[model samples]
Target: MKLQSTLVFSNELPPVKKLGEEILLIYDQILAQKSPSFGKWAKGISLKYPVKAGEHLKDIEQFPRHIKAITKLTEQTSVKKLTVVVVGGGSVGDFGGFVASILKRGVRLINIPSTWLAAIDSAHGGKTALNVGGAKNQIGTFYPADQIIMVRTVLMAQPEARAFEGFGELIKISLIEGGKLWSSLAKEKQINSKTLWKYLEAAVHAKYKVVAKDPHEKKGIRHVLNLGHTIGHVLESHYELPHGIAINYGLNFALRFSVQKKVMKPAEASRLFGEPVMGFLLSPLRDDLISVKSSDLAEYRRLLLSDKKKTKAATLRFVFVKKPGKTVIQEVTVDDLLIELCRQREEELHG
Candidate 1:
């Protein structure tokens, strides 16, 4: 998993002229329309696989069909010389990166992530994943791309709403790798495209510091990356929220849970919450958990059970932060989670 090269492009098309002679492009058609320059570059592509980017793109049931079609598309091209260039957000990158890893027993892969979330988080990780039975990331591979391209023009074009959504990952990594990253981000006046761009390099480097420690996640060090993801994934599935948006609330939940468990003192938790940037995670979002009926606990349990990262039956290795840049893992059962949900709902509504 050698993450060989990363290229940044500002208001420019990817330097296609410098790429491999034989290229097989897989891009999001929706993006082609947004950036006409992308469409123009696509016009020169003789054999391109344009796909609609979404969770559906990673459906395992439909994957056999996709591979059959893609294999036939590349039958004439030299597999040895072919480079699979994946151009899109996370879903498109996941599907295309998987295709490159397996097709012809692993071809060269170049990733161009298009959204703020993708640019900041998913594209660099090299964790290609697909969903099954509507649960997220059920199947996946660790096929790092030969090159990752971060095109500023594509990221800058993202809607303002997405900036709010993408901030979840930025803060997650910032909190984990505290010190300078957290110090700088905690005082931020606004979290927008410009703010995201300013902190992108530090965020990515901080994530790599964590990832480099546990590349395959065999060691528990990588479990820190799951700080907000346990409950976050369940909320994403149950509420039909975007992954990044769900994570924001999930992070809030984790911080509170840390206090409840006595992992962090109430005063310490309050001090952390007092920071200006904490508002980015807590404000402007309604707590959907308050609407959950007592009867809905069973369904929530089912969703948590379906999470692939669960290490033990009926339990999750939940990440709890002691403070910024320091965390501890706690094994919590489904009943504990359900009880905490009720307690949190009450706390939010009453306070």
Candidate 2:
């Protein structure tokens, strides 16, 4: 399937003046301080909305006020020629993409992701989302961007530690699209800007391949992309871990669960874990993060139910890997997930 958005790579931010005569720039406010060039460029825009990037920025209750302000900001601009350029990391991309999708019933959207996480994952999927009542992604639209520009300088400007946050998605896609992508990534010894940049193109294309097959995520084929997100989200919301860091733990949990369920052969699991890149999956703070107590079961269950991917009252389609590139989905109840979480926590504690 052909990708809806045109993908471009550049060493620096492109001239947004040429994108449209009337442009509404929705960007992370932090970029003004983080990137001088971005700050200078933003000053020239006639209509721009600078936003704080995070889960709170996606709160649905805040949407009305945001839209009203944006409406007033673009009141005189011609809708036909209006373009929304989003610049930021995942949460910013999510908020901006949601705004672009609804503003004037949609506009030409271009995403210039400033962080590796957005550039590699969120920026490509065209999944715009907003949270409601503290539940993540409760309301959203499948509004693909008109263009996705990955600026090298913008991404590299992020702190080196941010590379660890992007590694989860990078490894997740490589594992799902296994063969050359997996083989090459598995041998890498470092998780840094250079390594991420080297694999960024392949990782984005790998995601588009899955999304193209099931663009709307109606078909279960796209569920493969949720490899580590299930438990990952739980860890993220509960522990307040960075999305990528939480996903790293989530991927670790899923791999162990797959082996326990006999979905993946022990030899295969062993081989995959033995890879050099796999070492980066577990942070030094794993014990602090993965130690879920029995008292926390109620909260964990609540999070699992709140998941948008839940199929019935308490069951969700969980993605399990049999091997790199081969995954299986199974419907597991909330209780089932909690039991597994406790079991994993125990195993981590003892061994």
Candidate 3:
């Protein structure tokens, strides 16, 4: 499945105007209250599947119930002309995208990302997923939406706290692409929704560049995208942290590990962190704020192994940064990650 195209519009919802006659809108219920025009835009929608939207929404056990409801809701509509327009954050997009991919054996799908996190990262990827028990993204598909529409009002409507969430992916992309994005972004005095909007295009482009290289992830090229995601997913599942916030810590861990393992020059690592912007994104995480027992270490390892992207029996092709725009992938085991986690936690306590 080739990703069709992305339209990043400011203060407009232009793509929704041309939606197919039989539109099956799977939206976050929160949007109805948050977005002023959400109701108006949803006026003529054939079927509206309003979801709560979160990691819980991706539970595999709950999936059959959701799909069954959607099946009944769309039974009367013409599947050929049906379009699944998903409007929400990442989780809603994942659940809706998965629904659209399998609904009537694949239908035209569109995404109207309502959160900066979704607008900047997850919504564009074409990867749909559902979780098994507590494990994240265990089952999924590569179903790219036909179009991705980024509406300013909807995105801007998010709570200010949500900007912190968006920043993780925003910063991750900049660091991955490095060069100009890193230089300019690092100079910012403050990061807010506007800052996120300004770099939205570049971040999305950076992600697409990686995805295009290994769209199906058959080649190892795309594994670089998992820079912070390995430990990030574990923290998100174990600590119940927001995905973006968990990634912020995960990115920090990866950068430090890169330097500690002698894979990246200390000078290069210092230069990357010396940027004023790193101060906000690299602040101490909850892991540092709290103490970890051996039981916690065992639990963390269990969650880490459940990441679904491990290569060998207990190894992962962890992404390491050599410098801005330069990254290397190396085979790492669970024990290596555990040791680093403990070492990092100890350092946080001391310093």
Candidate 4:
């Protein structure tokens, strides 16, 4: 269960958590060293650190409120041929990438992700999204970053909750891309910066396998990565849960549901989510289950209708489970789907 240091380059960058407010200056140093390598890729780079730090980590829902402030701060600076901007975390990257994508028809993006959630999952993916009204990530564009620089230092400063929040996404990745790597992580006692960086590489490779094969999500291959995201997104929109936490809960619920449907065996589901790893156990039960009735289902349907993944036909496409490392994208009716959601609510209450 011991993660290897050889698989990860420990000296590439300092730990991000320890940097704090000096992150901007630290990044300036990184840019100075890489100036030659990024010569053609970027004209100039700048860090727009948040003045009034938001309550939690940056999120897409808070974009509009801060966009004007952000715009004012960076507006006076002369435009470089290629401007590379660094944002704090996932939401920052999402909105930052979206803005960069549309600025003067598009500009280069260089992300320096700070959170474990951002480092391991959201930051690398080409997807950028923002919330609109009551739905989650209702507005977004598909845009890729020019480069993403990961410094292990950030993980050290990350709160324990966020570290575990990121761990949830990592666990999901392991379930899909299972091997000795996954098993080792599932049993690790102390997940250190070195171990986090090690799996970050593996998770990226695993995700790349799916995204490369189906970059646009037109094929069902990439959709499998959304295994728990279906119910997960709805929960996020309805409750005020953080994105990663909501997804963790959704993943647990989906896994349990899959067992109920006989789509996967209990033993297999248990192994991936059975025991707690680093005090972050993905339980098969929900503590605060909220039931949505037939009327509430209508509202839920409205949110689904507005989902970015929807098409003109507007059918609910589920990234449901078939087995470990195997998933199927099935289109389900809203009514039928709500029934399943209600069942999940009931299960959460009794269990």
lDDT of 1 at 335: 74
Q: List, residue by residue over 118-210, the lDDT tens digit for candidate 1.
A: 887888767999999886788899988888777777787678888888999999889889899998899997989889888988888888888
Report the C-alpha lDDT of model 4 over 166-232, residue by residue, as the tens digit: 7678867876776755677777776555567678878877777677776656766777788677767
What's each prediction's TM-score?
0.92, 0.92, 0.91, 0.70
Tens-digit lDDT string for candidate 3 (1-351):
555455656576654558777888999998888877877777657578899988899999998899999999999878788989999999999999999999999988889899998899889868999999876788999999888888888888899889988999988888899888889998887888989888888888898988887778888887787889888888777777888988998898899999999988988878878888888765334345423678877787777776456443588789999888998999889889888887887777686
Q: What TM-score does candidate 3 get on C-alpha atoms?
A: 0.91
RMSD of 3: 2.6
Superposed by TM-score, candidate 2 places the C-alpha of residue 331 at a distance from the truth, in angstroms, of 2.1
List per-candidate RMSD values in Å.
Answer: 2.5, 2.6, 2.6, 8.2
Local distance difference test scores for all models: 0.83, 0.86, 0.84, 0.60
Error of 1 at 11 (Å): 4.0
Off by over 4 Å in 4: 1-81, 130-140, 189-198, 266-286, 289-315, 344-351
> How far off is residue 342 in model 4, in Å?
4.0
Best by lDDT: 2
Clashing pairs in 1: none
lDDT of 4: 0.60
In angstroms, the error of model 1 at 226 is 1.0
TM-score computed on alpha carbons, candidate 1: 0.92
The list of candidate 3 runs beyond 4 A from truth reads 283-287, 307-313, 349-351
